[model samples]
Target: MNRIIFAAAALAASAAIAYAQDPIVGNWKTELGDTAAIAACGSGYCITLKSGKHAGEQIGNFNGKDGSYEGKITDPDAKKTYDGSLTVSGNALKMKGCVLKVVCESQTWPRL
Candidate 1:
């Protein structure tokens, strides 16, 4: 019985660690230089602008794995949305977006 209890405890601990967010899965600055917090939302993730021009606006549905994700990011000031991609490495996060395949911009946001 003790062995079974230990095994169950180990399994639970491992599962908790697995579901925990990666380093980049927390607060960050956006391309517009605004601060936002990213959190799990419906099998993916959603980022809510914490400050600057887009405060309180949430960008949702970034689906990916292994530090790369893609979704739609909206600019609250301009009220425009673009196809956005995010790549995270260590303490740096690179975000890029294309505007209708005509123009694109990228920015590297350092962890906060």
Candidate 2:
């Protein structure tokens, strides 16, 4: 019984270690006034962007899951910045932009 218990404990510990080493612990690829924003977390994610000519003129909503977040994002093309709000789940992150507009979109991506 003691040997079985030790094996179980070892397996649990290994699983815990693997969870601790997750890579999607931060915000990623965010664009302002455009279509197609990118972000990954743990093993879950979400993405969005405005479509068409009004792309950069609209702000997208962050419907993030899991537990990730956005502290800040800069748009090189627009030469502007957006304060980020993020939600993360496993390997997914839902995002919302601080700027105001009418764009709501989400998608999951590989953890980066």
Candidate 3:
């Protein structure tokens, strides 16, 4: 009985950990004509919390409007940063992050 109980508990724990992996648990690139870099953002306003290459980055968050948000991105390694506003369309994470005040690049990528 003790062994059986332990086995059941272990199974449950493993299942839970597996479920914790979000849908956006993969690599994602920015769309064309946009500069800000982004990854797969899971459901419910979830965004990637990145470090190393891009640290201290930020994006915009809108005022209760769908697909309207602001974000800030930082790449400590590259010693770079991107700041701008964006919106998530039906199948894209649109970004236009910039430095100081310049819109450099943007792109659309399939969510991985």
Candidate 4:
């Protein structure tokens, strides 16, 4: 009985660790007024459009922690991919995409 209790405790600890997700895992309202979902995918997070004209499209993939990330972001309308970085603070997520690490555009997405 003691071994069983120890095993259960170990399992609970492992489960807690496994499910300790980042704050960026959730849905947000994009600058375009659409909904975007960010969820864990493999070793990184994937951003997908959950509403509006671009629904069902995956627009970004990022890898990082503590509210900062770096990856590539794709413009659905232009069909272009750019180097991107993201920062999350409070209920806002600032997304930036750049060309050659120079010219860039940014948008702040609110948590949904």
Highest lDDT among the candidates is held by which one? Answer: 4
What is the number of backbone collisions in each predicted candidate, taken in the order shown? Answer: 0, 20, 28, 0
- Model 2, residue 37: distance off in Å is 13
lDDT of each: 0.81, 0.48, 0.49, 0.95
lDDT tens digits by residue: candidate 1, 5-110: 9999999999998677665578886666788888778888888888986678896558787789999887677778899898899888888889886799888888
| TM-score result, candidate 1 | 0.76
Which segments of candidate 1 are over 4 A away from where they belong? 1-15, 18-20, 31-33
Q: What tens-digit string does per-residue lDDT give for candidate 4 at 38-64?
A: 999989999999999999999999999
Candidate 3 Cα deviation (angstroms), residue 41 = 11
The deviation in Å at residue 48 for candidate 4 is 0.4
lDDT of 2 at 39: 37
Q: Stretches of candidate 4 above 4 Å error?
A: 1-19
Residue-level error in angstroms, candidate 2, position 33? 17
Better of 3 and 4 by TM-score: 4
Residue 111 in model 2: shift from native, Å?
3.1
Error of 1 at 66 (Å): 0.9
Candidate with top TM-score is: 4
Residue 2 error for model 2, in Å? 25
lDDT of 3 by residue, 58-106 (tens): 4322221355665554433465667755565655655565777665555
